[model samples]
Target: MPAADLTRAALSAARVWLVGGGKMGGALLTGWLDHGVAPDNVTVIDPGLDQGPHGVRLAADPAAPLAEGPAPDVLLLAVKPQVMDSVLPAYRALGGGPTVVLSVAAGRLIAGFETAFGPGTPVVRSIPNTPAAVHRGMTVACANGHVTDTARATCEALLGAVGDIAWVTDEALIDAVTAVSGSGPAYVFWLTECMTQAGIDGGLPADLAARIARATVCGAGALMDASPEDPATLRRNVTSPNGTTAAALEVLMQESGGLGPLMSRAVAAATQRSQDLAG
Candidate 1:
């Protein structure tokens, strides 16, 4: 899409109300603000917001009617899964128009939204990681049948304000998305921790090992993003016959059950948990 088109699609009719202003909501709000979205067009409805963003109104309760503002063009539901029911009734009162509701709560489906907002309300379910705070997150979205092409575009634009957006036609894939990118950052952090411990075990000072491990992961990820080649090609380029990297790979990518299988199992377990939560 053209840059102007993308921007226009993203912010058009863009009066947005965020129902929760926790970490993920704050990340998205900051991103949108950084992208030149007028703070006046955004409202945060978090009771816990100690201080409001400049120019944006902060409300302690979204349960109350939208006090004199334009009906929201987009409603962002960012509360935890368990509290959606409690918080949804107030938002639902404003759903009779062309509003598109986008939710980031894990394990909730479009059907759950339909239950809350009545059928025919445009709903988009998304999974976004905490990395979004830095504008490097990956967000995956799925639209219910009620959502129009324009609504999808709008949703994409809103998510793109933070980082990348990928749409999935199959809603079932969203559980996998939750397992992967949604929960994947924690996994990567664990990997960093493990590598740092290994480095320390290999005789490096603890602080030095941690710093090296962190930088290595960040730098390698940046390099991978910059490179045109696939990761396998990149790995092959770094591995010499009988080299140290190759030796490590022998254990990580072993024949029977190695990192690949372990990761597959882990992702499957997470996907199953997401399904259970949705249930």
Candidate 2:
């Protein structure tokens, strides 16, 4: 599929204040530029980080004050949740004024931002996985009632600049989202690890086992993406009656102690952790 231009003129026209310049923030800034948003329109406010993209402004904190210039239409909050209380209120001026605050800080509720940024601030809580760095990210977002239609669109555009996005009506669902896509990549990585180990146990050379496992996992994903049929159908197509693949499936598909139940319990635990973190 062709690259999406979800930002439209939203990014180009808005004055953006980015609070973090770490990996995820950097990836998003790069995404805005790649999507043709003018470099001059964005500003970075990470004190610990040095320079940002070529033409964008970078300073230890707000260059002047949050209210000083352009009245930033969007304030991208990509900082850690733990330090948010101390670092976030400083940006309240932006929030109190016009900027729609979009936060990727996991576990921080929209109400938390509302409290810090002051009541009535339009706040968006988002969860983006590690794949965001490669622009294949799966981001899920939910906004407070204060978020205007235009503000929501702009937030979507900014996030869509990096990768695909999905919005949920219920903020509670975010915990489940966190359990699934937010941590899903790590599960995939762990699968590769297990598969590689299994191959080694079967007497394959370590290096060759790693390569085969890696390729098989990635190739399967690619095929899934390209095909119209469901995953179950795809799996059936690769399995022959009483064949090697069937033999493997018999074990893997076992109801009582197989991958299915294991993954279910894993996701449940992760969801509970996410909820705890939110608390």
Q: What lDDT does each candidate get?
A: 0.88, 0.87
Model 2 TM-score, 2 decimals: 0.94
Sliding window of 10 residues with minimal summed lDDT for model 1 = 62-71
Point to the candidate with the largest lDDT.
Answer: 1
Question: What is the number of backbone collisions in each predicted candidate, taken in the order shown?
Answer: 0, 0
TM-score of each: 0.96, 0.94
Identify the candidate with maximal TM-score: 1
Residue 71 shift from truth in candidate 2, angstroms: 2.2
Off by more than 4 A, model 2: 1-6, 63-67
Instruction: Give candidate 1's TM-score.
Output: 0.96
